[model samples]
Target: MKNYKLRRLSDQPILKTSDVKPSVDGFEVLGAFNPAACLVGDEVILLLRVAEAPRGKEGFILVPLIEEQNGTPELAIKEFNEPAAPYDPRVVTLNGKVYLTSLSHLRIARSRDGIQFTIDENPFLFPARMDESFGIEDARITFLEGKYWITYTAVSEHGPGVGLAITTDFKTVERIGMILPPPNKDVALFPQRINDKYMLLHRPMVSDIGKPSIWLAESEDGVHWGNHRFLFGGRGLADNPFAWEGAKIGAGPEPILTDEGWLLCYHGADPTHSYSLALALLDKNDPAKVLDRSDAPMLTPELLWEREGFFPNVVFSNGWIQWPDGRIWVYYGAADSGVGVAELVRE
Candidate 1:
């Protein structure tokens, strides 16, 4: 899409590494991960991405903490210092010493308002051995039928896919295994069932058939999904040769049902690997029909920190919370390093 636009809530990082725990033993907090926000006890609670460690490490795992030293948040690495487990080059390394790359984990942070936040002492979610060996990213929380449903990316060496977790209280989560398998991601379930059936937006990658596009599916139960159909495809633009989502486009957060239609915040990536956020309006009943979509990005990497980080020129969001005050608060990961927030007009 080309004509859509977005406004920056905070030009600089409002909730940066300072909002998380600090690093110990020469390690430091790097970035935050997939953020899930909700209203708890009249407060906006944020599930932030807290990636920690020193620059250039291969084998160490960094856990974030709030440190008194320099009064700055940093990461503390769990050093193996073992010769057998060699360092992985994929993670950052500093000096001549090698540290293992830290995997992404979900940590809780609370704010009386929504702007300033303080991280919880403990993490709300971590990688489970059954399938999420790599890490979990991008979680969409839907409070449905008195229960909260979380759909997130379950990563492993096998590949990245979508997984389901249910919870009545945010403290405990019950795993529902991988809901969707490899070569697919960006799954968002409708908050309520339509015609007694569950609806979801998913992206199934087909390298040979065509470019990655959005698909719609329905299920009797939330677990098993079927009736998959291609919902939308990329459209090319003159200025943006790699337009129509040069790479892919999928549902971002849960669809916000409004009088206009179903407002969907989605992410689109170009061939150059730059990722940005966009919006689409779908028919309330027949989500397969698109009413309107943003031609340009709603959010992009323009800030200095957003342009210069782990993965430059990237702004990805897993979830957003709409307040009763007609404000939609968007929480996204900036450059894959840390999390940031943006507010948009609900209408």
Candidate 2:
């Protein structure tokens, strides 16, 4: 087995503890910034998942909204504590009063140095209808042809699904609507066309029939997709319980094509529910065929911030930028609170 080492690119949280704490309206838990980098003029832009909740309380499920408090836009939390409601682990129960957590929308933040980021004054995206009332999360950006392609998680009462939007400039987005329907998310589009067809990674949740596993889909026009097939599932000496992901594992960023194969960084959660970052290499021509995969994580919750926060023992990445000099800059959410970056040598 070949050993791969990942190094911290930035010593501190790149997007937290600001001298000026920018108002994210009703957002509280912010994470899963995808593509992590885009070229805008001479600068690189990042679109972050800003999870919002109301003030002074917590629960499992509720809708988030931007409410003005003391002339400042703050994330408002609402609790849904109905006994008939679905099960959620994040909420607490007390005195037959079921309290739910509120989640609302996504915000944008940009950086010049790819370290220090400035939150936009306004939201980049939000859930405007009943279908997406639960908000959006974990966006993946793929710049292809002449447009930036974005695939994100659209949560609602129906279930979690994947949504698509495109942008020529990061400021304005043209929503392509829900590309993949219910119980499916974590969609990542390849950076370029494969054999002149678009390729994507998606997870279709089959609760009763099967476990959540990574699947491959192809599209000729990048909108309409077909040819769905299982790419990989939870399997190894390390894999136990033999159930969908043991916890969960999915595509990280757009695969980096190298002479060896397609280098893929993925996130895997153990039975303990602790999240870690792992690596895999797939055949270049047939990406669905797995060539090799790391049994353990290449990056885990080793840092103080990563080990402790809103959720501990989590280091998740959706975006990584490869420099011409061969350094890979990976921007990831740490402990579900803020964003962090790391560097790995491309061997």
Pick the TM-score winner: 2
lDDT value, candidate 2, whole model: 0.70
TM-score of each: 0.81, 0.83
Candidate 1: tens digits of C-alpha lDDT, residues 188-277: 888898878899998887766787788999998899999998888766443575363667777787888988778888888877778888
What are the lDDT scores of the predictions, listed in order?
A: 0.71, 0.70
**What are the root-mean-square deviations of the candidates from the true structure over C-alphas?**
7.1, 5.2
Off by over 4 Å in 2: 1-3, 17-35, 57-62, 65-100, 236-245
Deviation of model 1 at 47, angstroms: 2.3
